[model samples]
Target: MNILFDVGASGGALLHNASEMDIDLRNVDVIVISHGHYDHTGGLLDALKIINKPTAIIIHPDALALKYAIKPKFRLTGVPHTISEIKKHGGRFLVTHDSVFLTDSVATTGEIKRETDFEKTPEYYMLIRGGKVAQDKLLDDQALVINHEKGLIVITGCAHAGVVNTIRHAQKIFGRRDVYAVIGGFHLIGASDERIEKTVESLIEINPRIVGPCHCTGDKALKIISDNFAGKFTEVRVGTVLNL
Candidate 1:
């Protein structure tokens, strides 16, 4: 079963890349949204329009909540399309906070538990309250766990919950410590040096076979991970594919 994870910043890019890869969007059996961030859900409308079958969209209920980043400037950072817009385009949402088993071998991490002190969500990130701003813990952040024969493959988008925490959650849920690969954002951009070091240390303890950091994983952290992980680190991009 082919599962299409978080759509990129826009439909145009996703469509173009799919075409290049000879992947039919209509053939996609499931759509999983990691969070409600604009970069991840911006192309939902266009994607729903193209898929022919009744695809199930798995996502956290809180992902639909309004979210924003208040550090640099005030701006809307939530999903670009509304639930109505998604439904208007034939998108079927299966929103839940509990871990969902998409298939016998694949499952969602659900709401990741934040147990690490250093991987705390940035204070500047906030959600709009009743005429006020409140810190956004990003409880909606989750990841996809594929239990391959060798080990588990964890895929995430932004990983607002914290990469180490997400990985640990996946391991606990699957009852396995052998992580085959971890692909997607680490969300370590603008993080402090101490936090980055702690994150890397945690990752090393888990010791996945391969690491593919993308999107919001900052340059500094990426370099540090790449250097430490050496041959195991792989850079992921829009068109990159991981063969399980």
Candidate 2:
């Protein structure tokens, strides 16, 4: 049941980190790309080669679309590898917009539904559509859901779909509200204090047994979440592993 989720900024970094953790890339059963972001998918080709065998790579088709960060300056921020390249490197891609069950208790949320008004993906980029620049709805944003014995464990990448929405989507798919843990980027960077506060309150209602916000969760938001979650908050880092 070895699963790799969202490769890091570079393939070398992925390999280095795996080596540090004593993880053999060859044994990974599957690879899941949370979104098309460069940080998440840049190592795809290298990972595929490391596996060197037929492997299922789960991701959304929209992850291939041209993506950019328009602020400060327009910068490309999408997957660096081509679909053909991936296929040539022992990659069996499963691109879809529906839940994909890896196991009876493990699956992806597919396309998360944005139900909260305050929980919106910050305007980071304008995605190309019909040869025109359009607002990125990030419909491809999804998360992994694990039906643990205590409750569901949701893992996200960037969380452009909104963490609450991601969790709720997991709950809907799994038919449970009890979440054991949530560990990943919440994408609350540069968000308003009000939004961060509201998000923490919403999370309190969901009441995950453990909350580990990392990456794009933002420093300010992390402090707020830490303050609100208190005993339940866990500091996540590279090599940090959650048993549940």
Candidate 3:
């Protein structure tokens, strides 16, 4: 199996090199959105138009809505694509609010439960509805787990759910902790020093074979992981592809 469709990555990562990468755009089987952010979802419109088959579009329902911050209140908006819109474009929409399997090899852990008490959600995240704070728990934040021949691989978008939480959920879902690798955004941008330290500690505890932090994982966090994990850490760019 292959990552037929990825996060709505902008700058035409796949769009510019679909053929060279040997990925058949017309045969894409699954499309997984990491979050509602445009940078990860912006390319779906064109991708959908190209895919001839009915591809499964997996996403959390809450992610399609608005996301907000509390401290000083700034806009970090979510993409404005509803399930209906996806269906209109012939997408096989898979709306998930809980852990579910999309296939034998591919499954989503729904919204990962914050298994660790130490890992706390950022305070700035808030759900506003009708000009009211909804205290959204981000129940739809999910990750894709692929059971490869080597070991289980976890692919995430932004990892709004704690990275530790995402891993634990993957372990539970697969009934094992033998993670071959984890790729994609860790969402550790702008994290405090303490948080970064804790995150590094947790990653070392898990000891994944490979950690490819891309997108929102800030440079400082990447450096810390590299300094600690060394050979295990690798850079993930738009054209980068990791095979299990």
| Per-residue lDDT of candidate 2, residues 88-150 (tens digit) | 999898989999999999999898888999987657676775688877778888899999999
Candidate 1 local lDDT, 121-156, one digit each (tens) = 877767764666678788889999999998999998
TM-score per model over all chains? 0.95, 0.97, 0.87
Q: How are the candidates ranked when ordered by lDDT, highest leading?
A: 2, 1, 3
Worst 10 residues of 1 by lDDT: 124-133
Pairs of residues at least 3 apart in sequence or in different chains that clash in candidate 3 = 8-40, 8-41
For 1-244, candidate 3 gives per-residue lDDT tens digits of 4455354554266567775677667767787776666667767766787785577887777766776666666766566466676677777867677766777877877878887765666666767556677766666677889877777788877787878889889999988888889887887888888888998899898999999988888999989988998889888885687656
Clashes of each: 0, 0, 2
Count of clashing pairs, candidate 1: 0
- In terms of TM-score, the best-performing candidate is 2
lDDT of each: 0.88, 0.90, 0.76
Q: Report model 3's TM-score to 2 decimal places.
A: 0.87
In terms of lDDT, model 3 sits at 0.76
Q: Best candidate per lDDT, number?
A: 2
